[model samples]
Target: MAKKLIAESAAAPESFEQAMAELAQLVTQMEAGQLPLEASVAAYARGSELVRYCAAQLEKVESQVKVLEGDMLKPFAADGAGEGMQ
Candidate 1:
């Protein structure tokens, strides 16, 4: 039963936000030290999957942004214009 639950949770999240939320919840549960050893191990595995999913999503977005910018990704200028742009 526990294995089944863990396997179901291991499914990929619908989006990055969902993955992050699930990962945070898992961390909280693990930190509380309430789960049995087997459950804790399962949670750790699921957390790893979430982390990978989030990273892949971020990477995909970044690549898309780079292409949109003509593959010229530059440092962000909070002031809207850097000194050299003048």
Candidate 2:
């Protein structure tokens, strides 16, 4: 079952959300501790792939945002106009 899932995961995730969802599902199943050693290994491998995929997706978006913002990334301020905001 785990190997089958890993094989299925080989077909790249359609989107970041999909990858995250799959990764979460894998974590839940592995945490159950019911899988055999081989299955666990397979799940770990697939999880790693999902993590990489998500990271790459985030990097791509970050680069685009940086370009759009002309690299003027500002530190986020929480309390709305907290001193020197203007």
Best by TM-score: 2
Candidate that scores best on lDDT: 2
Candidate 2: where are CA atoms >4 Å away? Answer: 78-86
Please write out the lDDT profile of model 1 over residues 1-86, one tens digit for every residue. 54565677777799999899889888988898878899989999999989989999999999999999999887787666676876
Q: Give the least accurate 10-residue stretch of model 1, judged by summed lDDT.
A: 1-10
Question: How close to the true structure is residue 26 of candidate 1, measured as C-alpha lDDT?
Answer: 84
Candidate 1 deviant stretches above 4 angstroms = 1-8, 78-86
Residues 12-32, model 2: lDDT tens digits: 899999999999989998999
**Which 10 consecutive positions of candidate 2 have the poorest summed lDDT?**
72-81
True lDDT of residue 76, candidate 2: 72
